[model samples]
Target chain A: MSEYTPFEMIAYTGSRVLKDERIVFVGTGLPIIAAMHAQLTHAPNLYMIYEAGSLAPILEMGMPLSVGDTRAARKACYLKGLCGAFELTQRGCADYAFIGGAQVDMYGNICSTIEGHNYDKPGIRFPGSGGAGAMAANCEKTIAIMALEKRRFVKKLDFVTSIGFGDGAPDYREKAGVLGSGPYRVITNQALFGFDEATKRMMLLEVKPGRTPAEIQELVDFELIIPPDVKEMAEPTDEDLRLLRDVIDAEGYFLKRVIKK
Target chain B: MINTVSSNIKNISTLEYKEKKFEYWGPTPDESRKLMVNKSHALKDKRMSLKEAVGKHIRDGINLGIGGFVNTRVPVAIIHEIIRHGARDLTLSFQSNSICPELLAGAMILDPDRVSIKRVELAWWGYEIIGIAPMVRYLATNGIIEMDDYTNYGMSVRFKAASMGIPFIPVRDHGGSDMELVNRGKMIECPFTGKNVYLLPACHPDVGIVHTTAADMYGNARIFGAYCTCPEIAMAANATIMTTEKVIPTESIRSYPNLTEIPFPVVDTVTEVQYGAHPGASYGYYWFDMDHIKMFRSICEDFRKTGNKDALKKYYDEYIFGCENHDDFLEKIGYKTLKKLKDMDGGQPIILT
Candidate 1:
């Protein structure tokens, strides 16, 4: 078996979670790769709408470097302004939106704004929320992708840049006027997690191959809400790994090269 | 120099203002009156060379809007001129940006004094840094510049509010998010329904620069594809400057009135510059110069690794300073590569009239 990178696993799991015929509102980085993989594999009819205004692009070339990558507009069916694209999401046409963050809470809330408690004087200040806020509020379902680490998988976020499900109470999102049903899944390196319908707390859905439940539990900051039938995640097939390394990421922009150090 | 004023100004009703507790998303009745009044006035032909436009309009510490989405239809020639002129302390705003801001930041234009303090303030309405250029990250991390964030939709709606001459526009997105903390907006209860909505204030830049496929001498501009925020930028800015690949006849603009993105009345200046969105794609005109972009990224990466100012200086010297103007810059890119990019869109070079 060929050794697969954690990024491939994250991408594979994300693609698998996405269903066919769903219009995906995609951000840059890992989400682009996952969407491309899905398009190539199970979901050929997956329509992608980039925040930069390209809609339903064929993505003839490999994965775009960013949502604004020129490839995103190549042969696009419709080109809109930034406002028009989000307006569609607000109208609830987008079934899923893929987002990444610096920190995620148990309720699936994402914090990409700052690290420390103080907003003005932070331990670390990230590039503040862009479209993540709007995507979280409007998209019918949000799929959050992040690195699995103790700090990242926090019990509480430093700041709520995007609300998942406020306290995970029933009708919490509805009260906030969010059109979508908060986060459907949180895909990380070690395992896959889903939000509890009632509480909105993240529950360990499945562990990836070679990684034990105990190993994932160690990494998470919050307590695990493992169900009785917790199963091992399916490993990337030979074909999946081959397509990822060879076709989608032939240039190694995402897989091999670490642009953001 | 050919000079002609735009004679057509349609009579649109100005909105009237009645004191309402709820903030409208568009122009209020009173503000609509001003916009309608502004629309009635004809725009004089203020055509000039790209150099003249930059010199006459741009100033230090100016709030500028560089219009484009990602790599599409960026006003590259105007940006090159701003760099060439050494404009300082610019507060740059964009909804969805690409290489233009990064190039400025990389050239040390954002920090002309070589001090750690940034001369530029970068305000964008997007989630992540979209470009491959490293300057944005460098500025944010090094505390060189003040970074203000807004959602892509939030920023665009703010522009829309400015275009309509409104004080603020109410939006539904930022109600529960922490966007309200950094961004200047208020969560007010809707008087009619008692529901809450975020009210985003209107933002009008000192100058809005956009590149379009064609514009008349009167600055009636027509964008071919993906008219991102050009119309809003044009209407919202105190002054609007347009760079275009071709300057067609006013009759042609009149022929397709509905297709015109920026009407003549809103345009302050127009400069005809071919290949104005190089290293970025101008839809239906040329594809992105990927090789050039790759080279730029490498330069940026090298600078990030070394923390050497000379690396960026060398790039500016080679790409921006070494070239006299847009034509010279295109020449440095060479005719072959330019031809290949243009051929990708099956477009012929616009012959200067």
Candidate 2:
């Protein structure tokens, strides 16, 4: 058994879904790592668009400090403004969008705003949404990465800031003029999931090394579909770990906090 | 209370009889008028020093509104003082799409509760999280602090409405999409666009803390490059705290007054903190400190995973707070980290700023 660092795990999870000819709208962090891993391995031509408007620029390794990290400008073939990024997304130019959801329901509606317990007073607030609204609505396909937990994966979202897969993917599409295919997959540390193509509800596709089907199911507030063909996700390889470490080079990021005697 | 009121009436009566034979029932109407007048802007139009004016109201839980988009136009000096004083629970509200590395560093080393309402994290290209985005997500997942997420246009529209002082602004865009959050009633929504359109309310914050390259003593602030939504946010806030690099006489504003977007009347207090956006050193003032950016990212990432501020504070004390100035912050984080970061293969670090 090979050891998997957090970075390697991130790259492996991302590589599973990203294939060639996929133009992925990427945010910073895990999505970028995953996209990069895909670029390194199977999907050499994976088109990665940063929110600040770089398309398929050569990204430096390790985690980016931010989406606008100078690396983006240094590595890109082209650069566009915030508004320009949306223009591309709205026109169905992007193939896949990797986004994060604060709260998600069984329907694939995301609540990135307040937790929805109190509309007037939120427990916490984020920087206002940027192109997420357009990307969530217009992109051809979407993938949401929410770290695992019942709080994150809920029965019903407090609100849907972004729509991935809804109650009836077809029904929501008719109601909303949404052009995208909805959330294609939901990636978390615990497992990998996708919506049932027919029902558009979450169906568990793969699980992490230490997770069991029942354990994964129990953590979700809503019912998750466990397909009969569910398999264990491939653990991170040593080479993958080395690349991730070299590229992301987050030395002493949490070393002091790691409780060394 | 009745005896005091009666005594006050008698004293007024005696004084009036001795001087001009005036009658008083409830003290003098002029005295009451004076009291009422003193309550509103009666400081006699005097200009005070930055230390004197800024000392009183700077405290924790205070929301600071920064100008500019990311690191381009932030108030560096005030941020420096904020770190110097160890301000806590300082929720920042900005118009630009996301957080900057400097601000992220502050949140990482200063405060981990990077309170904001941006819809997404790291929306800009090349901006690195320095570990803040993942940290923010980690903290949000762990319930360390609240995370208010909105879509990009959603936050912008909300800021626009806030600037206009409109109670709510209805957006026709983003309707009938999965990303239409405001319409779902998860946030404030208008009844008309049940589909994809949303109603964003005015975001009148507690304080509008901004920094500009130059300003007049009368408090007219002008920023060079990418104004973002700073002026509008300042106008919408309850109080506006401004920091400027250069301070000119009020008469200086008369030359190119129209350029002064923030008038003296709009600014509550102005601190002359030069070269303020440290680590993200203000454009044209100093080169961007890549080392500082890496430190900020690393700290943010550490805070995100552990949700431990004590540890963060220790790091800050060792590196950030221990430093005398921005240069020290750069030194403690070390050029090695930045050089190592430079060696990474993929994209450059994309900071939210």
Highest DockQ scorer: 1
lDDT of 2 by residue, A144-243 (tens): 8876788888876654556555555355553454567777887876688888877888889998877798999988998988888888887877777665
* Per-prediction CA RMSD (Å): 9.0, 14.9
Candidate 1's residue-wise lDDT over A147-208, tens digit each? 88898888777777786875666755554545787799999867999977767788899998
Cα lDDT of model 2 by residue, B229-251, tens digit: 56765665556667675676666
| Among all candidates shown, the one with the greatest TM-score | 1
Candidate 1 Cα errors over 4 Å, as ranges: A1-3, A61-63, A115-125, A166-177, A241-250, A258-261, B1-40, B43-46, B107-133, B142-144, B294-307, B343-353
lDDT of 2: 0.54
Listed in order, the DockQ scores are 0.26, 0.13
List candidate 2 stretches off by more than 4 Å. Answer: A60-63, A122-134, A209-212, A248-261, B1-65, B69-73, B78-93, B96-150, B157-274, B279-353
Cα error, residue B346 of model 1, in Å, equals 7.6
